[model samples]
Target: MSAAVERARAMIGVPFRLHGRSRAGLDCVGLAALALGREAPGDYGLRSGDVARAEGWLRAAGLRPVAQGRPGDLALARPGPLQLHLMIGTGAGFVHAHAGLGRVVEMPGVSPWPILGWWAVE
Candidate 1:
Protein backbone atom coordinates (compact mmCIF):
# COMPACT_ATOMS: atom_id res chain seq x y z
CA MET A 1 0.00 0.00 0.00
CA SER A 2 1.07 3.61 -0.38
CA ALA A 3 2.60 5.38 2.59
CA ALA A 4 -0.37 7.71 2.89
CA VAL A 5 -2.80 4.78 2.85
CA GLU A 6 -0.73 2.89 5.38
CA ARG A 7 -0.56 5.91 7.64
CA ALA A 8 -4.27 6.51 7.39
CA ARG A 9 -5.07 2.85 8.00
CA ALA A 10 -2.98 2.99 11.15
CA MET A 11 -5.49 5.49 12.51
CA ILE A 12 -8.43 3.13 12.29
CA GLY A 13 -10.46 2.89 15.50
CA VAL A 14 -9.55 6.38 16.65
CA PRO A 15 -12.50 7.99 18.34
CA PHE A 16 -14.39 10.75 16.56
CA ARG A 17 -14.54 14.23 18.06
CA LEU A 18 -15.44 17.57 16.60
CA HIS A 19 -12.32 19.61 15.82
CA GLY A 20 -10.14 16.77 17.11
CA ARG A 21 -6.89 15.69 15.43
CA SER A 22 -4.95 13.25 17.52
CA ARG A 23 -4.39 9.53 17.60
CA ALA A 24 -6.59 9.29 20.68
CA GLY A 25 -9.32 11.36 19.08
CA LEU A 26 -9.63 12.75 15.59
CA ASP A 27 -12.24 14.38 13.40
CA CYS A 28 -12.22 14.03 9.63
CA VAL A 29 -10.05 17.07 8.93
CA GLY A 30 -7.82 16.32 11.85
CA LEU A 31 -7.21 12.85 10.53
CA ALA A 32 -6.11 14.34 7.21
CA ALA A 33 -3.78 16.86 8.81
CA LEU A 34 -2.21 14.23 11.01
CA ALA A 35 -1.69 11.89 8.11
CA LEU A 36 -0.35 14.68 5.90
CA GLY A 37 1.63 16.48 8.62
CA ARG A 38 0.33 19.88 7.57
CA GLU A 39 -1.55 22.62 9.31
CA ALA A 40 -5.01 23.09 7.91
CA PRO A 41 -6.80 26.41 8.24
CA GLY A 42 -9.30 26.89 11.09
CA ASP A 43 -12.21 28.19 8.99
CA TYR A 44 -12.37 24.94 7.10
CA GLY A 45 -15.61 23.66 8.53
CA LEU A 46 -17.38 20.68 7.06
CA ARG A 47 -20.56 22.58 6.36
CA SER A 48 -19.37 26.14 6.39
CA GLY A 49 -18.26 26.91 2.85
CA ASP A 50 -18.45 25.65 -0.69
CA VAL A 51 -16.02 23.21 -2.31
CA ALA A 52 -14.22 26.04 -4.10
CA ARG A 53 -13.09 27.63 -0.86
CA ALA A 54 -11.86 24.35 0.47
CA GLU A 55 -9.94 23.68 -2.70
CA GLY A 56 -8.46 27.17 -2.63
CA TRP A 57 -7.10 26.70 0.87
CA LEU A 58 -5.49 23.39 0.03
CA ARG A 59 -3.96 24.88 -3.06
CA ALA A 60 -2.48 27.73 -1.02
CA ALA A 61 -0.74 25.09 1.04
CA GLY A 62 1.35 24.10 -1.97
CA LEU A 63 -0.45 20.78 -2.36
CA ARG A 64 -0.83 19.94 -6.02
CA PRO A 65 -4.37 19.48 -7.24
CA VAL A 66 -5.02 16.46 -9.39
CA ALA A 67 -7.85 15.97 -11.89
CA GLN A 68 -8.68 12.76 -10.10
CA GLY A 69 -7.58 11.31 -6.82
CA ARG A 70 -4.95 8.62 -7.11
CA PRO A 71 -3.65 6.18 -4.51
CA GLY A 72 -2.06 8.77 -2.22
CA ASP A 73 -3.96 12.02 -2.37
CA LEU A 74 -5.17 13.59 0.82
CA ALA A 75 -8.89 14.28 0.77
CA LEU A 76 -10.72 17.12 2.45
CA ALA A 77 -14.38 18.07 2.53
CA ARG A 78 -14.71 20.71 5.20
CA PRO A 79 -13.03 23.70 6.79
CA GLY A 80 -10.68 24.00 9.72
CA PRO A 81 -7.61 21.92 10.27
CA LEU A 82 -9.45 19.73 12.71
CA GLN A 83 -13.15 19.91 11.98
CA LEU A 84 -13.55 18.65 8.43
CA HIS A 85 -13.69 15.37 6.57
CA LEU A 86 -10.22 13.94 5.92
CA MET A 87 -9.10 10.83 4.09
CA ILE A 88 -6.24 9.23 2.24
CA GLY A 89 -6.55 7.98 -1.30
CA THR A 90 -5.84 4.40 -2.23
CA GLY A 91 -6.25 3.35 -5.83
CA ALA A 92 -9.25 1.19 -5.03
CA GLY A 93 -10.40 2.86 -1.81
CA PHE A 94 -9.91 5.53 0.83
CA VAL A 95 -9.17 5.61 4.56
CA HIS A 96 -11.00 8.14 6.69
CA ALA A 97 -12.63 8.79 10.04
CA HIS A 98 -16.40 8.57 10.22
CA ALA A 99 -18.54 9.98 13.00
CA GLY A 100 -21.30 7.48 12.34
CA LEU A 101 -18.88 4.57 12.51
CA GLY A 102 -17.01 6.13 15.46
CA ARG A 103 -13.59 5.40 14.07
CA VAL A 104 -11.34 5.53 11.05
CA VAL A 105 -12.46 3.17 8.32
CA GLU A 106 -11.28 2.15 4.88
CA MET A 107 -13.99 2.77 2.33
CA PRO A 108 -13.78 0.96 -0.95
CA GLY A 109 -14.21 2.91 -4.21
CA VAL A 110 -14.01 6.62 -4.95
CA SER A 111 -16.18 8.69 -2.67
CA PRO A 112 -19.55 9.44 -4.19
CA TRP A 113 -19.77 12.79 -2.41
CA PRO A 114 -18.82 15.84 -4.46
CA ILE A 115 -15.14 16.10 -3.66
CA LEU A 116 -13.60 19.58 -3.85
CA GLY A 117 -10.26 18.18 -4.99
CA TRP A 118 -7.38 15.94 -3.97
CA TRP A 119 -3.90 16.76 -2.57
CA ALA A 120 -1.02 14.65 -3.72
CA VAL A 121 0.83 13.43 -0.67
CA GLU A 122 2.79 10.70 -2.35
Candidate 2:
Protein backbone atom coordinates (compact mmCIF):
# COMPACT_ATOMS: atom_id res chain seq x y z
CA MET A 1 0.00 0.00 0.00
CA SER A 2 0.99 3.61 -0.43
CA ALA A 3 2.88 5.32 2.38
CA ALA A 4 0.20 7.98 2.67
CA VAL A 5 -2.49 5.35 3.11
CA GLU A 6 -0.38 3.59 5.69
CA ARG A 7 0.13 6.81 7.58
CA ALA A 8 -3.58 7.56 7.62
CA ARG A 9 -4.42 4.07 8.78
CA ALA A 10 -1.88 4.37 11.56
CA MET A 11 -3.80 7.38 12.83
CA ILE A 12 -7.05 5.55 13.26
CA GLY A 13 -8.66 6.03 16.71
CA VAL A 14 -7.04 9.39 17.41
CA PRO A 15 -9.45 11.70 19.20
CA PHE A 16 -11.22 14.31 17.11
CA ARG A 17 -10.92 17.94 18.08
CA LEU A 18 -12.02 20.93 16.10
CA HIS A 19 -8.96 22.63 14.59
CA GLY A 20 -6.67 20.07 16.22
CA ARG A 21 -3.35 19.26 14.50
CA SER A 22 -1.44 16.55 16.30
CA ARG A 23 -1.42 13.02 17.59
CA ALA A 24 -3.24 14.20 20.71
CA GLY A 25 -6.20 15.01 18.43
CA LEU A 26 -7.05 15.92 14.86
CA ASP A 27 -9.70 17.35 12.59
CA CYS A 28 -10.28 16.20 9.02
CA VAL A 29 -7.81 18.71 7.57
CA GLY A 30 -5.25 17.90 10.22
CA LEU A 31 -5.54 14.20 9.52
CA ALA A 32 -5.09 14.78 5.81
CA ALA A 33 -2.08 16.99 6.35
CA LEU A 34 -0.39 14.53 8.67
CA ALA A 35 -0.96 11.59 6.37
CA LEU A 36 0.38 13.50 3.37
CA GLY A 37 3.38 14.79 5.39
CA ARG A 38 2.42 18.43 4.92
CA GLU A 39 2.11 21.20 7.42
CA ALA A 40 -1.39 21.60 8.74
CA PRO A 41 -3.18 24.92 8.43
CA GLY A 42 -3.55 26.64 11.77
CA ASP A 43 -6.66 28.61 10.90
CA TYR A 44 -9.70 26.71 9.75
CA GLY A 45 -13.28 26.14 10.82
CA LEU A 46 -15.32 23.05 11.45
CA ARG A 47 -17.15 23.65 8.21
CA SER A 48 -15.99 25.24 4.98
CA GLY A 49 -17.99 26.53 2.05
CA ASP A 50 -15.03 27.56 -0.06
CA VAL A 51 -14.20 24.92 -2.58
CA ALA A 52 -11.38 26.85 -4.16
CA ARG A 53 -9.61 27.22 -0.85
CA ALA A 54 -9.68 23.51 -0.26
CA GLU A 55 -8.35 22.79 -3.74
CA GLY A 56 -5.66 25.39 -3.25
CA TRP A 57 -4.52 23.77 -0.05
CA LEU A 58 -4.23 20.42 -1.80
CA ARG A 59 -2.24 21.95 -4.62
CA ALA A 60 0.02 23.75 -2.19
CA ALA A 61 0.80 20.38 -0.65
CA GLY A 62 1.91 19.11 -4.06
CA LEU A 63 -1.30 17.33 -4.91
CA ARG A 64 -3.13 17.58 -8.20
CA PRO A 65 -6.69 16.93 -9.22
CA VAL A 66 -7.35 13.40 -10.37
CA ALA A 67 -10.05 11.97 -12.62
CA GLN A 68 -10.22 8.86 -10.47
CA GLY A 69 -9.24 8.23 -6.87
CA ARG A 70 -6.93 5.47 -5.69
CA PRO A 71 -5.22 4.43 -2.49
CA GLY A 72 -3.49 7.35 -0.79
CA ASP A 73 -5.46 9.93 -2.78
CA LEU A 74 -7.31 12.61 -0.90
CA ALA A 75 -11.07 12.69 -1.20
CA LEU A 76 -12.96 15.93 -0.79
CA ALA A 77 -16.46 15.21 0.36
CA ARG A 78 -19.56 17.19 1.24
CA PRO A 79 -21.40 15.81 4.21
CA GLY A 80 -23.77 18.75 4.64
CA PRO A 81 -24.49 22.23 3.38
CA LEU A 82 -21.44 24.47 3.54
CA GLN A 83 -19.46 21.58 5.03
CA LEU A 84 -16.46 20.10 3.32
CA HIS A 85 -14.76 17.02 4.75
CA LEU A 86 -11.46 15.44 3.80
CA MET A 87 -10.59 11.74 3.81
CA ILE A 88 -7.70 9.56 2.69
CA GLY A 89 -8.44 6.72 0.30
CA THR A 90 -7.33 3.21 1.35
CA GLY A 91 -8.20 1.40 -1.89
CA ALA A 92 -10.76 -0.70 -0.06
CA GLY A 93 -12.30 2.28 1.68
CA PHE A 94 -11.29 5.51 3.41
CA VAL A 95 -9.71 6.80 6.61
CA HIS A 96 -10.68 10.09 8.25
CA ALA A 97 -11.19 11.91 11.47
CA HIS A 98 -14.93 11.72 12.05
CA ALA A 99 -16.29 14.56 14.12
CA GLY A 100 -19.50 12.82 15.04
CA LEU A 101 -17.62 9.71 15.97
CA GLY A 102 -15.20 11.82 18.00
CA ARG A 103 -12.19 10.01 16.53
CA VAL A 104 -10.39 8.90 13.44
CA VAL A 105 -11.93 5.86 11.77
CA GLU A 106 -11.71 3.58 8.78
CA MET A 107 -14.88 3.31 6.78
CA PRO A 108 -15.13 0.40 4.43
CA GLY A 109 -16.94 0.31 1.08
CA VAL A 110 -18.61 3.41 -0.35
CA SER A 111 -18.35 6.75 1.36
CA PRO A 112 -21.29 7.87 3.45
CA TRP A 113 -21.08 11.34 1.94
CA PRO A 114 -20.92 12.69 -1.60
CA ILE A 115 -17.36 13.07 -2.89
CA LEU A 116 -16.75 16.36 -4.66
CA GLY A 117 -13.24 15.76 -5.91
CA TRP A 118 -10.11 13.65 -5.70
CA TRP A 119 -6.56 14.90 -5.22
CA ALA A 120 -3.44 12.83 -5.76
CA VAL A 121 -0.04 13.48 -4.24
CA GLU A 122 2.62 14.29 -6.83
Candidate 3:
Protein backbone atom coordinates (compact mmCIF):
# COMPACT_ATOMS: atom_id res chain seq x y z
CA MET A 1 0.00 0.00 0.00
CA SER A 2 1.08 3.58 -0.52
CA ALA A 3 2.48 5.54 2.39
CA ALA A 4 -0.43 7.97 2.11
CA VAL A 5 -2.91 5.10 2.31
CA GLU A 6 -1.12 3.77 5.36
CA ARG A 7 -1.25 7.18 6.96
CA ALA A 8 -4.97 7.44 6.31
CA ARG A 9 -5.76 3.96 7.62
CA ALA A 10 -3.98 4.82 10.83
CA MET A 11 -6.62 7.45 11.52
CA ILE A 12 -9.62 5.16 11.46
CA GLY A 13 -12.24 5.82 14.15
CA VAL A 14 -11.14 9.37 14.93
CA PRO A 15 -14.02 11.59 15.92
CA PHE A 16 -15.41 13.91 13.29
CA ARG A 17 -15.54 17.66 13.83
CA LEU A 18 -16.32 20.46 11.51
CA HIS A 19 -13.16 22.41 10.59
CA GLY A 20 -11.10 20.16 12.86
CA ARG A 21 -7.48 19.47 11.94
CA SER A 22 -5.98 17.07 14.45
CA ARG A 23 -6.15 13.45 15.52
CA ALA A 24 -8.59 14.33 18.25
CA GLY A 25 -11.07 15.31 15.57
CA LEU A 26 -11.14 15.81 11.83
CA ASP A 27 -13.31 16.75 8.90
CA CYS A 28 -12.89 15.32 5.41
CA VAL A 29 -10.49 18.06 4.30
CA GLY A 30 -8.51 17.74 7.49
CA LEU A 31 -8.23 13.99 7.12
CA ALA A 32 -7.12 14.30 3.54
CA ALA A 33 -4.53 16.89 4.48
CA LEU A 34 -3.17 14.83 7.34
CA ALA A 35 -3.01 11.66 5.28
CA LEU A 36 -1.33 13.37 2.36
CA GLY A 37 1.04 15.29 4.64
CA ARG A 38 -0.18 18.67 3.52
CA GLU A 39 -1.77 21.73 5.10
CA ALA A 40 -5.38 22.70 4.53
CA PRO A 41 -7.25 25.92 5.05
CA GLY A 42 -9.63 26.15 8.00
CA ASP A 43 -11.73 29.09 6.85
CA TYR A 44 -14.48 27.06 5.34
CA GLY A 45 -18.04 26.24 6.23
CA LEU A 46 -19.82 22.87 6.57
CA ARG A 47 -21.52 23.41 3.22
CA SER A 48 -18.78 24.94 1.17
CA GLY A 49 -19.51 26.32 -2.27
CA ASP A 50 -15.92 27.20 -3.02
CA VAL A 51 -14.73 24.17 -4.93
CA ALA A 52 -12.04 26.27 -6.64
CA ARG A 53 -10.56 27.09 -3.26
CA ALA A 54 -10.44 23.42 -2.30
CA GLU A 55 -8.97 22.50 -5.67
CA GLY A 56 -6.42 25.25 -5.26
CA TRP A 57 -5.37 23.85 -1.92
CA LEU A 58 -4.95 20.39 -3.43
CA ARG A 59 -2.90 21.78 -6.26
CA ALA A 60 -0.79 23.82 -3.88
CA ALA A 61 -0.10 20.64 -1.97
CA GLY A 62 1.50 19.17 -5.08
CA LEU A 63 -1.48 17.17 -6.25
CA ARG A 64 -2.58 17.10 -9.85
CA PRO A 65 -6.00 16.28 -11.22
CA VAL A 66 -6.13 12.73 -12.53
CA ALA A 67 -8.46 10.75 -14.73
CA GLN A 68 -9.32 8.37 -11.93
CA GLY A 69 -8.46 7.71 -8.32
CA ARG A 70 -6.05 4.97 -7.27
CA PRO A 71 -4.63 4.13 -3.86
CA GLY A 72 -3.42 7.29 -2.08
CA ASP A 73 -5.22 9.64 -4.42
CA LEU A 74 -7.67 12.30 -3.22
CA ALA A 75 -11.31 12.25 -4.23
CA LEU A 76 -13.65 15.24 -4.34
CA ALA A 77 -17.19 14.05 -3.99
CA ARG A 78 -20.62 15.51 -3.52
CA PRO A 79 -22.48 13.66 -0.82
CA GLY A 80 -25.27 16.26 -0.87
CA PRO A 81 -26.33 19.16 -3.02
CA LEU A 82 -24.25 21.62 -1.01
CA GLN A 83 -21.74 19.33 0.57
CA LEU A 84 -18.29 18.84 -0.87
CA HIS A 85 -16.55 15.92 0.76
CA LEU A 86 -12.97 14.82 0.51
CA MET A 87 -11.61 11.30 0.93
CA ILE A 88 -8.41 9.34 0.57
CA GLY A 89 -8.47 6.44 -1.82
CA THR A 90 -7.37 2.96 -0.83
CA GLY A 91 -6.91 0.28 -3.47
CA ALA A 92 -10.20 -1.34 -2.54
CA GLY A 93 -11.88 1.44 -0.57
CA PHE A 94 -11.76 4.98 0.74
CA VAL A 95 -10.88 6.61 4.06
CA HIS A 96 -12.90 9.61 5.14
CA ALA A 97 -14.16 11.45 8.17
CA HIS A 98 -17.88 10.72 8.07
CA ALA A 99 -19.86 13.42 9.84
CA GLY A 100 -23.01 11.31 9.93
CA LEU A 101 -21.06 8.50 11.60
CA GLY A 102 -19.28 11.00 13.85
CA ARG A 103 -15.93 9.34 13.08
CA VAL A 104 -13.51 8.33 10.44
CA VAL A 105 -14.25 5.18 8.47
CA GLU A 106 -13.12 3.06 5.56
CA MET A 107 -15.85 2.21 3.13
CA PRO A 108 -15.23 -0.65 0.75
CA GLY A 109 -16.00 -0.80 -2.98
CA VAL A 110 -17.16 2.07 -5.16
CA SER A 111 -17.88 5.54 -3.73
CA PRO A 112 -21.32 6.10 -2.22
CA TRP A 113 -21.50 9.64 -3.63
CA PRO A 114 -20.87 11.21 -7.00
CA ILE A 115 -17.19 11.91 -7.58
CA LEU A 116 -16.41 15.35 -8.96
CA GLY A 117 -12.68 15.02 -9.36
CA TRP A 118 -9.62 12.97 -8.48
CA TRP A 119 -6.21 14.25 -7.48
CA ALA A 120 -2.88 12.46 -7.08
CA VAL A 121 0.31 13.57 -5.39
CA GLU A 122 2.40 12.38 -8.28
Candidate 4:
Protein backbone atom coordinates (compact mmCIF):
# COMPACT_ATOMS: atom_id res chain seq x y z
CA MET A 1 0.00 0.00 0.00
CA SER A 2 1.10 3.54 -0.64
CA ALA A 3 2.15 5.87 2.12
CA ALA A 4 -0.73 8.10 1.14
CA VAL A 5 -3.23 5.33 1.73
CA GLU A 6 -1.67 4.57 5.07
CA ARG A 7 -1.97 8.21 5.96
CA ALA A 8 -5.60 8.20 4.92
CA ARG A 9 -6.32 5.06 6.93
CA ALA A 10 -5.05 6.92 9.96
CA MET A 11 -7.94 9.34 9.49
CA ILE A 12 -10.73 6.82 9.81
CA GLY A 13 -13.33 7.88 12.40
CA VAL A 14 -12.47 11.56 12.22
CA PRO A 15 -15.63 13.57 12.59
CA PHE A 16 -17.15 15.17 9.52
CA ARG A 17 -17.48 18.90 9.47
CA LEU A 18 -18.38 20.86 6.37
CA HIS A 19 -15.59 23.18 5.29
CA GLY A 20 -13.39 21.81 8.06
CA ARG A 21 -9.80 20.73 7.45
CA SER A 22 -8.28 19.19 10.50
CA ARG A 23 -7.95 15.95 12.44
CA ALA A 24 -10.73 17.18 14.69
CA GLY A 25 -13.00 17.25 11.68
CA LEU A 26 -12.94 17.52 7.91
CA ASP A 27 -14.99 17.43 4.76
CA CYS A 28 -14.29 14.95 1.97
CA VAL A 29 -11.97 17.32 0.10
CA GLY A 30 -10.10 18.01 3.29
CA LEU A 31 -9.59 14.28 3.75
CA ALA A 32 -8.26 14.00 0.20
CA ALA A 33 -5.83 16.84 0.76
CA LEU A 34 -4.71 15.21 3.97
CA ALA A 35 -4.21 11.88 2.23
CA LEU A 36 -2.44 13.32 -0.79
CA GLY A 37 -0.44 15.87 1.19
CA ARG A 38 -1.62 18.66 -1.08
CA GLU A 39 -3.06 22.01 -0.30
CA ALA A 40 -6.54 22.07 -1.66
CA PRO A 41 -8.14 25.35 -2.72
CA GLY A 42 -10.36 27.18 -0.28
CA ASP A 43 -13.60 25.65 0.79
CA TYR A 44 -16.73 25.84 -1.34
CA GLY A 45 -20.15 24.28 -0.87
CA LEU A 46 -21.99 22.19 -3.42
CA ARG A 47 -20.79 23.74 -6.67
CA SER A 48 -18.56 23.31 -9.69
CA GLY A 49 -16.05 25.49 -7.87
CA ASP A 50 -15.17 22.53 -5.68
CA VAL A 51 -14.62 20.29 -8.71
CA ALA A 52 -12.39 22.89 -10.32
CA ARG A 53 -10.47 23.29 -7.13
CA ALA A 54 -9.90 19.55 -6.81
CA GLU A 55 -8.92 19.26 -10.46
CA GLY A 56 -6.45 22.07 -10.08
CA TRP A 57 -4.76 20.36 -7.16
CA LEU A 58 -4.74 16.99 -8.88
CA ARG A 59 -3.29 18.49 -12.02
CA ALA A 60 -0.70 20.30 -9.97
CA ALA A 61 0.21 16.95 -8.42
CA GLY A 62 0.62 15.52 -11.94
CA LEU A 63 -2.08 12.94 -11.31
CA ARG A 64 -3.45 11.09 -14.31
CA PRO A 65 -6.90 9.59 -14.83
CA VAL A 66 -7.10 5.82 -14.65
CA ALA A 67 -9.77 3.24 -15.46
CA GLN A 68 -9.15 1.46 -12.17
CA GLY A 69 -8.05 2.94 -8.88
CA ARG A 70 -5.02 1.65 -7.03
CA PRO A 71 -4.09 2.03 -3.41
CA GLY A 72 -3.84 5.70 -2.49
CA ASP A 73 -5.41 6.76 -5.78
CA LEU A 74 -7.91 9.58 -5.76
CA ALA A 75 -11.52 8.88 -6.53
CA LEU A 76 -13.78 11.77 -7.36
CA ALA A 77 -17.47 11.28 -6.71
CA ARG A 78 -19.77 13.41 -8.78
CA PRO A 79 -23.50 13.30 -8.48
CA GLY A 80 -23.56 15.95 -11.16
CA PRO A 81 -21.01 17.81 -13.22
CA LEU A 82 -20.61 20.38 -10.51
CA GLN A 83 -20.81 18.76 -7.10
CA LEU A 84 -17.78 16.65 -6.27
CA HIS A 85 -16.53 14.61 -3.34
CA LEU A 86 -13.04 13.18 -2.91
CA MET A 87 -11.94 9.84 -1.47
CA ILE A 88 -8.66 8.01 -1.01
CA GLY A 89 -8.42 4.54 -2.49
CA THR A 90 -7.44 1.67 -0.17
CA GLY A 91 -7.22 -0.94 -2.94
CA ALA A 92 -9.77 -3.13 -1.22
CA GLY A 93 -12.02 -0.13 -0.73
CA PHE A 94 -11.85 3.60 -0.11
CA VAL A 95 -11.69 6.05 2.76
CA HIS A 96 -13.59 9.33 2.93
CA ALA A 97 -15.31 11.71 5.25
CA HIS A 98 -19.06 11.27 5.37
CA ALA A 99 -21.18 14.18 6.53
CA GLY A 100 -24.17 11.95 7.02
CA LEU A 101 -22.15 9.48 9.06
CA GLY A 102 -20.35 12.39 10.70
CA ARG A 103 -16.98 10.68 10.40
CA VAL A 104 -14.33 9.32 8.08
CA VAL A 105 -14.46 5.61 7.32
CA GLU A 106 -13.04 2.88 5.14
CA MET A 107 -15.66 1.43 2.86
CA PRO A 108 -15.46 -2.05 1.36
CA GLY A 109 -15.29 -1.66 -2.41
CA VAL A 110 -13.49 0.35 -5.03
CA SER A 111 -15.84 3.14 -4.03
CA PRO A 112 -18.97 3.50 -1.99
CA TRP A 113 -20.06 6.36 -4.19
CA PRO A 114 -20.37 6.67 -7.94
CA ILE A 115 -16.99 7.45 -9.40
CA LEU A 116 -16.66 10.41 -11.71
CA GLY A 117 -13.04 9.52 -12.23
CA TRP A 118 -10.07 7.86 -10.59
CA TRP A 119 -6.68 9.57 -10.66
CA ALA A 120 -3.42 7.85 -9.96
CA VAL A 121 -0.95 9.97 -8.04
CA GLU A 122 2.46 9.81 -9.59
Candidate lDDT values, in order: 0.72, 0.90, 0.88, 0.80
TM-score of 2: 0.94
TM-score of 4: 0.83
Clashing pairs in 4: none
Candidate 1: segments with Cα more than 4 A from true spot: 76-84
Q: Give lDDT: candidate 2, residue 111.
A: 95
Query: Cα deviation of 54 in candidate 3 (Å)?
Result: 2.0
> After superposition, which runs of candidate 3 have C-alpha atoms over 4 Å from their true positions?
none
lDDT for each residue of candidate 3 in 1-122, tens digit (9 for 90 to 100): 99999999999999998888999999898999899988787565437656787787778788999997889999998888877899999989899999999999999999999988999985
lDDT-based ranking? 2, 3, 4, 1
lDDT at 71 for candidate 2?
Answer: 95
TM-score of each: 0.80, 0.94, 0.92, 0.83
Candidate number achieving the greatest TM-score relative to the actual structure: 2
Candidate with best lDDT? 2
| TM-score, predicted candidate 1 vs. hidden true structure | 0.80
lDDT value for model 4: 0.80
Q: Write the per-residue lDDT of candidate 1 for residues 17-107, one digit (tens) a residue.
A: 7778788888777877777767767877466655666777677766777777777687665434333465788788778878888888888
